[model samples]
Target: MLVAAAVCPSPPLLVPEVAAGAAPELDRARAACFDAVAVLAAARPDRLLLVGTAPEAESGDYPAGSAGSFRGFGVALDVRLGGGEPGPRELPPSLTVGAWLLERTHWQAAPPTARALPDTLPPGDCLAAGRELAAGDERLALLVLGDGSACRSAKAPGAWDERAEPFDAAVAGALGTADGPALAALDPVLARQLHVAGRAGWQLLAGAAEGADLAGRLLYDEAPYGVGYLAATWS
Candidate 1:
């Protein structure tokens, strides 16, 4: 059963070494992520499910010990999912950030499991995956890593798109309220066009929390470097 959840952005800049000179820009987002993770720890779940985007065309399960590095982002920092020994898979940036947050929180109570779903996965399939995770008898918590839209300003990664603001606002609202149906209703085509990578994972969250009575709190919402980054906690 679902117990608690934390929504966070997956930017490599979340790591100080990767962010370099721009490290302080995301200080608040980082703090909010820590606060959200703290909520998960307080919940004392049986296990934690780290859900985020993967480069694969289909969803894949990763061992708790999966390791990944930020060398591609000009940083040699490496992170492991949990205390377990290194596994075969190399997590993508999303899960890597999740691992970093877990490490910062020193997560220990619940064993952690990682699941990476393709960014362009269909909404139905995303929901199905979420449902299966929620079906488990153990109390499961989720650490979801994803970014809203990258087109908030003229200098944004995707360039300024008039549609980006509304799209991001909707996403923040959905996450802040734990409105599963609203998240499920997010338009995939529009999201893709706006360069929003959080759609699939957020939809999966909707599936996982389908019938649960979770209370939500919007911890942070901002567009640092023109990427809409949000953090929220549901308990």
Candidate 2:
């Protein structure tokens, strides 16, 4: 199996032609959502799975009037292949992987800000969901998440330095999208953080200067945030 990951590096809030400024919070949320989808696709497994929990009301800084967030959600897509003469009963495999991933991974509440929530989404639950969706076929699995710190920073448990390269620039270059205006508008620190995450994403998929390839012949495209995007094939 091979994997490829890419980031969009912050898509335009408002159309480039529009004069209105982009919404920072909204952009961040959108980018995070898109990044999650990209991660799952990179895994290139038969089924797509998502495992996460909503914030508790007692949790500090919980948003008022917010419905409980998605603790976990998952979806499975059926793929079929046929020889030369396509049979009418045979279905196309690419009917809608992107849309399926989007529909399955979307979150209603704010993205997980603290590590507590994601940790609650145990690997067991993720695996179970994938199993059910894939009918017990678990040869490989894909995991995706938002939060820049999730990929970097040693503070979080299980945080590894596997892929630390910047993912933002590579995504931008691959998707043929730009964030010059957004970067100029953001605070220097935030801008730098975004860039760093982008680079890290690239490094994760592309590998370090002297490291082995984590993914092979992976295809990348532009997404929402300055996050990298990737699509990989796995067994």
Candidate 3:
């Protein structure tokens, strides 16, 4: 069963080395992410599973200790899913961010197992995957990573769109309250058009926590660099 969960944005900028001088801008988001991970640790789960957005071809399961690097972003930093023998699997950017979070927190409760899912994945499939993952005796904790709409301003990655603000606001509200149904109900087409990479990941989390009676607390919600980044904890 899902005992706890942490929701975070997947931008590579979360890493100081990647963000360079702009790192200070995300200090609060980073702090919130750490706090959310602290909550996961407090849950004392027997296992930790990380889910994140990735390219369709890259979407798949990654074993503990799978490696990822920020070399593509001109950073020399390397990260692994958890403490274990290094594997040949290379994590996509989103999982790379998740691995960085786990490393930052020094997750000691359990070695993390990870999955990367494409943003275009159907909601039903995401839910089914979550249910399958949660159908076990082990106490499971999740670290979900993906970004929301990236079209908040003209300079945004997706450029300005009138619908972006409302879409992101709804996402922020759902995440803040842990409204599973609401997350599951997001419009895939609209989300995709708005460049909301986190939609599928959030739906997966909703499915995992289908009947869980955890309370939620929104730690951070902001659109820095015209991208929506959120941090929240459910426990």
Candidate 4:
């Protein structure tokens, strides 16, 4: 069953080395992520499933020690998913950010398992995958990573879009309350047009937490750098 979850944004800039001078701007979001992880640790789950968006069409499982690097972002810094020996496959940017969070928190409770789903995955499929993940007998926690709309402002990566604000607001509401149906109801076409990369991952989260009695707390929500970066915890 799902015991806890931490929702975070997937941006290479979360790494201090990658952000450099602009690193300070994301300090609050980083701190909130740490706090969310701390809550998950407190739950003492048996496993931690790291969920994120990927370029693939379906979920991709990454071993506990999979490695990820920020070299593509002009940084050579490397991160391993857990303390275990490194695996053969390296993580994508989304999972790389998830790995960085686990490393930052020095995750020591439950072992982490990585999984990523395609951005265009249907919500029903995401929910099904989530239900299957939650079916395991062992207590499970999740570290979900993906960014909201990238076009919150004219300076946004995807440029300004009138629909961005309302879309992000709804997402924030769903996450803040752990409202499964709301997340599951997100409009794929609108999300795509708005550049919301986190839709699939968040829908998966809704599926995993279905019927779970966890309460939610919104830790952080902002459109820093023109990307919607939200942090929340459910436990």
For model 4, the stretches where C-alpha displacement exceeds 4 angstroms are 57-59
Q: How far is candidate 1 from the true structure (C-alpha RMSD, Å)?
A: 1.1
Q: List model 3 lDDT by residue over 1-235, tens digit each.
A: 9999999998999999899999999999999998999999999999998899888889888999899999999999999888788777799999999899889988888888899998899999989988887887789999999898999999999999989999988988888888999999999999999999899989999999998888889999999989989899989
Per-residue alpha-carbon lDDT of candidate 2 for residues 1-235, written as tens digits (9 for 90 to 100): 2222223222222111221344553444444445545554545544332222223322121111222211111222232111122223311111112222343445232221111122233333333332343333332232222223223334423243434224433333332322222212223243233333222222222221111123322234333233333332212
Q: Give candidate 2 regions above 4 Å deviation.
A: 1-44, 56-137, 149-235
Which residue window of length 10 is worst by lDDT in model 3?
A: 80-89
Instruction: Name the top lDDT candidate.
Output: 3
TM-score of candidate 3 against the unseen true structure:
0.98
Residues 158-229 of candidate 4: C-alpha lDDT, one tens digit per residue: 999989988998999989998889999999999999889899989999999998898889999999978899
TM-score of 2: 0.25
Candidates 2 and 3 compared by TM-score, better number: 3
The true-versus-predicted C-alpha distance at residue 4 of model 3, in Å, is 0.5
TM agreement with the true structure for every prediction: 0.97, 0.25, 0.98, 0.97
